[model samples]
Every structure is written in structure tokens, then in C-alpha cells.
Target: MADEAQQGQLVNDRYRLVRALGSGGMGRVWKAHDVQLDTHVAVKELLLPSGFSAPDRADLLERALREARSAARLRAHPNVVTVHDVTLVGGVPWIVMELVSGSTLQERLRVEHRLPVEEVAEVASALLRALGAAHAEGIVHRDVKPANVMLTEDGRILLADFGIALNEADDGLTGTGVVIGSMPYLSPERARGEKGGAPSDLFSLGTTLYEAVEGVSPFKRETKVGSQYAVAHASVPPPRHAGRLEPLIKGLMERDPDARLTVAGALELLAPAKPAPPPPVSPPPAFSPPAPEPPEPEPRPASAPGIRAAAAAPSESRPSTTRPAPARAASAGARIRAGGRTRRVPAPPPRRPLRGLVLFAAGAVLIAGGSYAAYQWTRTQYFVGVNDGHVAVFRGINQELGGTPLWEVETDHPEIELRYLPVYQRKQVEATITADGPDDARARAAQLALQASACAKNAGENGEDSVLTEEERLLTDRCGN
Candidate 1:
């Protein structure tokens, strides 16, 4: 990586770079100042890695420049990321545009896991509006994912990353068998090596929105092979949230493109009218003001021309108006009569016992304790107690020595020793006795006393390494711990 100051100096005379924003496979984007306009803009410089041949470099530059110009046409819409100009500095292609202050939708999704249904609807509506604008202009955004959507701090949504966008007028630039775009968000038709359309972009948007609402995309799998299979035929599951809009999310995430709602159609489905709040019970007091007296009638002229003028004049008669009259208030004796018949508020019902939780916990504890006891009993076969602090196995022994189990008889103190003793006879190993008690010092004293009454016998068999093989190690890794 180069220093920020040094990288900014690489801009042409017309544009002064500020800082490098980020870089991708084909280009690096920088925040720069357009010296001619004195405004901040993002300059995307196309760079073909050394791996590409000269011919490939020329093709990439031309394709990138053409796409940038096509994206510039979408600047008329507010939701679409604006592209300003395309230029070349030292024969390398570059694009200048408005700088957006926000994190990518990908970053948001990674942190949030999934959004609520209403939130999903809001974001999807914004995205669809942007897409509708582009599709109207015959521009198809080949790649649509959370990474390409910019979410501003103030909550405005902007569709970005038009690097792979295709203009309806331009000839095909992508080579055959080369599938572009992110695999998880790719439409089924695109995954099958077909040219993507507005519907294809909508499908990608559906997948992105599905993940935003469901915590996982419908077509996601642990392996690329599995993902590919899922894209071919699998339908994504509905969002886990039980809000009012779960069905709408399901509609958007349908497997068949035809079954999915169109962008305009989805906008309507997502934008719901909020319920109006109830009106207050108390009414404002009514006031009575004296009405103005009727205006005095004007005198009429006594002539034929005056008679015609009087006929054409507006009505002089005062309009009759009616006002709502105040009703009479009840007397104190009438109010006292009505108060005696008021109904009493009922008391709450008695609380019920939660038997379900108590039974479930009891069952769970029994299963866990039984499993632990069975595990402990199986481990006692190989080793026998030599003393309070040690165990007597065969002549040889091996242990991974992960950790020692704590003694539960007294307190759960690790210092307390527990053991199993093997009683030996002439040239034979006999029964084993288990003991777990208090302080380690006391246990050791008891072990020494027991040892005095016992006699040493022939050693048992030797032990060998049981470390897992390489194949088993790989299998465990794949299965997940």
C-alpha cells in the first residue's frame, strides 16, 4: 500500500485526490476534490493486475469506461449513486462521482444478523425504487447485493457499485462461461450462464432482502457445490420474525421469478398505512356569541336601465344561519340518581401454577445426570487407584491429561483426590474399589493405611497411543465441534 498523500498526488491536473477509499479486483476508489468545481467526489481508477495480457487490459479498460458512462445516466434519480465524469490519467481509466458518507449494507447485515419485517420492507422499497428508475432507462444492474447498497447514517438508502452494470445499447462484453457477480446473490438464470435482465436483478435483490429478513439467504450452503445446487432449485425459507409482514417477505423471496412481486408492486405491499389513534373522550366547551344584525338593504334606482342593473346585482337578503344550541346541564339531584347505578369493576382471576416448566426442568436434570453417571462408570474400567493422589493402571499408561474432575463429596475442590483401587492377587488383577472424600491429606493417609494390608502383584498389560489419524482429524473438522 502507498501513503495517502502519495496516492492522492496520482490524480490528473484537473482533479486533486484526498484519500484512497477502497480497492477491488479491477480498480481503486479515492475521495478527491474536483479542482475545477471545488467539490468532493469519488474517483474510481481502473487497474488491471499484471496477470492480465495487454489485450485483456485494453478490453477491461474499455468495458469499465463504457459502464461508468452508462451509470452516469442514472444520476437523475435520487436513490441511484450519481456518476459525474470519466477520464484517463496516464492511460489508466478513472470515474469521478459524488462521495457518499455511509457504510455498505453488507457491513450492516453482518452486524445485525437480520432486520425486522417493517425494516426489511422499508429498505426493500428504497432499493426497488432505485431499481425501477434504472430499469426505466434500460439499464440493468448485473450485480445487486448488500455490498453495493450504501446505508447512510441518517437512514437514506443508495444503490451503488455500478461497475458490472450493462447498457441495453452496448454489445456483450463478458466472455462466455465466465459467471460474474457474487455466487450467493446470483439469479438462477445467471448461474446457468444466461444474460441477466431486470427480473434477474430483482431476483438478486430478493435474495439480498431475504437474507436481511431471514438471517440467511435461501440459496446459501456450507459448500460451493451445495450453494450451486440450491440456486438451481431450492426455495428460500420465510423470515423467522412473526410480525405482520412475514407473508410479504415470503412473497418477495419466492423461488420463481414470475411469482415474485415486481419492484413497483413490492413498493405498494411494503408501504402500509399506520393505524390512526383513538380520539380523546372529553369535548371542548361550546361558546355562544351574539350574531351580527343583518345588513341594511340598498335603495333601488327608479329607471329601466337601473331596473336591469338591479336584476343583475347579487342578492341583498341576509342568509339565514343556524348554530348548534347549548344543551341544558343536569341538576345535582339528577347526577346523584345516575351515580347510584354505576357498574363495579371486576377483580382479576387467581394465578395458576406453572406445572409445565417444573416438569420439563425435572426431566432435563434426570437425563443430564444419568448421562454423566454412565460416562463416569465407563471410564473406571482401565485405571485403578494406587494411592489417594494417583491411579494405578497397567505397567504402562497414556492420557491426554486435558483436566482433572473436581471432588463433589465435600465441596467441589480440585485439591480433593478421588481414586479407584485395584485389589491384586497372585499373578492376577482382581476387583476395584472407588473412593472420593474430603481433604487430599486425609485421603492420602487412608490410602497408605490400606496399602499396608495389601500385597504387590504382577503388573498389568502395557498401553499404546490412541491419537486420531489424519483422516479422522479431517472428518472431525468437517463435522464441526
Candidate 2:
């Protein structure tokens, strides 16, 4: 015990780690052994990463501890993953959960693209069972999403990660005013800053089912405002492949939480129905229109009035359309005007071709960006690195080839660890910038850390810049020693 404690040690005098299961913006999750209990268990090491207000860190830690308590209260449910224990070691919370083996719905989506409606019905049943259990126990799994679901090897779906659960027994964990749930799956009531409940979980389940069959979120859009608007005001676009299950999906996703389908009602909806859905058409890429829809005006009709009017005339082929405009006067006059006279000008080289070409080039870029961003926003949640004038934490992973800034915080901590901050996304304000680029310290730290990781990968162990060695120094404050 003495030797083991000296070398990594057992957590809470019981669990000994065997191997890391995975790591994300949250700290590492490990497959571990419970020596005292004589069983295998899963352990999560939660960090208080640098960069959060003291109050938020405190609330976050308390809420995380509540995760164990909340899930444990629902241990009787087969679909709810069991929580065994939680321990505080060095200000980090170690969560001991049931050892379930299999892939996540998130990972499955990455491979299968979209699942059959039959399979999605099964998923919905599993999720509703878990939510029903939690709800019965007065616990709300506030952060439900595809990523939070675990599909076991033996064909069972388990609900995991209740870290931000709302426990009716205690409302203390909330009230920090931080919205901590994935935006795409966020219930409209919650998305609009209203209180959420069992109905909200059902709404999220509808989204997960939608994503499973449609391969896209019902309310997904390029920007936060657009997405929130979709969630709040815009109707969910019909799921082309949902077939008979469409009614249930829509019922669960009602904007008014009180009116959404109940867990019990959904169970009835999950019964195998008559007439299977037609074979799915290949899903369009994220940025592309789902089907041939009404065309957008070239150069984005919403923004450029001049370009829309200039481009509209020739396409409409109606001179009457031109007669109506102060919008078109300048472009027409510019094309035929003379300094002294309204003399005829040899049909000035057609400006439409040039305008169309430039518009296409510009529109192509935004469309491409929108597509990539939509995919990443809905399918893959982001990781944020904490930046305090102190040691750099695991900043490397945050620097992916193309990632979006989904959230931010104002903190004074030397370092803070948040297992899941991306879930609490604030709207993007892209207009502000400094000459140095991205006033976001996390962005800068991530870029620099990746540079360091790349250097180590190419130069080997003895390299001046090594991710592993520098990480140790940052954590230990032994830099330059």
C-alpha cells in the first residue's frame, strides 16, 4: 500500500487505474479496479482547469459531486448507469461509475452516419426508460445528448454522465446562471432561459432521435442566434426519413415544455409500427441544402441589396422590375452614363458575368464554412483551454484543424478545471478583435500548445519543445528548474 501510494496510488483507498478510457475537455476517464470491493469500475478525474470565476468553480465542483448522488439514487433502473462513489483528491473529483463496455451513440453516428428509424425507436425507448427512472427519483439529467448515451456490447443502451443533473432535493447546484447543456439538444424552454424539467429531457431525446435518423439537428444553423431562433421560433423541418415515428418526434419536441410528450407517452409511441420507412436517401452534406429548396439570391440576398437588385434584373427578364427602383438606378446609370450627355454607349461589357463570378466565389466560401461549422456544432462539441497567467494545462487538444469558439468565461484562477464547459455556450461575438488576433486567450494558448505538440512529435523526446515535459512543468510549477 505504501509503495502503491507513492507511485500514482489508489484513489479513495480502493480504485486502482488499469488504463485510460478516454480524455476530452473533461479530464481523463479511466478503466479501474476496485480493490476493496473486488470489482471493476470506471473512474473520472475531474479538473478545475484554469479560467473560471471562483463562484462558478465552486458551484461546478458541488454540482459534479452531486452527479454521483443523483445517479446513485436511480440505481435500480437498468438503463441508468450506476454510480458507486466520488472522492476529492487534490481539489479534483474522482467519480466511480459502473463499468459498461461499448461505444457511444456519438461514436456510432460518426460511423453509421444515420441509423434506421427502427433502431432510433429502440434508442428512444432506452433513453425514456432512463429518464423516467431519474425523474421518478426527482433528478433531471439536464445534459442529455447523443454523447451522453452509452450503447453496450450486449445490446443495451445506458444513460451516463449526470454531472450537471438538477436534484430536486437540492437546488443549490444551480442558480449560478450558467447554462450547462449542449445547445443543439437544449430544449426550447431551456434554450430561451426558461426552467426545464422532464419535458426538456424528452425534447433532447427527440433531437437525438432526429439526428440518428436524419443525420442532422432539426434546429441547427450557422450561428448561435440562428440556432437559438430555430429552437425557439422556427418550426423543426420535417424529418424526411422519420416516417410514422415523425409524430412522436414532433410531439416530444414541442416548444412549450408542458405540451411536449411525456416519458410514459413516448414509451407507447415506441411500439413497432406498421409500414416501415422507405430506404433513406443519401444525406446531403452539412452545409448543402437538405433537398432542392428555393434558391438563395446570389451573394446572399439578406445582406447585399445592391448585388441582389443588380443580379435580379437580368434573371427576371422583366424591364418593369427595373422601373421600380432607386435600388437599380445607380448600377444602370453607371453602366450607360456619360460625363456630358446621355449619349448611347456601346453595350458596356456585361457586368453581370463579373458580378456573378465574384458572388459565386464569395458565396461558396461562406457556404463551405457554414456546412463545416454546422456539422461540428451539432455533432462534435468543442474543448476550451483555460488561460490564467499561470501554467498551461492540456491546451493542445483544443487546437484542432478547424474548431469553433462555443463558450467563454471570466475567471481569475491560477488554473481551473471544468469537465464540460462547451455545453454552456454563450453567443458568438466575432466582431471584436485585436491586431494580435482572437482576443480569446484560450485560442492563443491552444494554437501555441499544438505548435509545441507538433514540435515534439517531429523532434522526438529531447526536443526543446515537448508537450509531455512542458505539461508536467506547468502542472508542477517547476518550469526552468
* Leading candidate by lDDT: 2
Cα lDDT tens digits for candidate 1, 349-444: 545558977898999999999968855754432322333344333211223224644222221222212221221110011222222222322343
lDDT of each: 0.60, 0.64
Q: After superposition, how far is residue 199 of candidate 1 from its true place, in Å?
A: 0.5
Clashing pairs in 2: 47-417, 48-416, 48-417, 49-416, 49-417, 50-415, 50-416, 287-371
TM-score of each: 0.52, 0.52
Model 1 gets an lDDT of 0.60
Q: lDDT per residue, candidate 2, 1-481, as tens digits?
A: 4223333457878888876666544466777888987988988877544566887787688777876576787777889788888788877778889987666787555433565676778888889988998888888887688888988766778998775676654332245554656677888887777777778888988988889877677777898677777777777788888877898898888877778889888888777656978898997868855464343333323477887688557664545644554543343223343563343323335556788999999999999999778656533322233444321323122323446543443322232222111111100011111111223334533433433343333345435544455443322211111
**Model 1 steric clash pairs:** 385-420
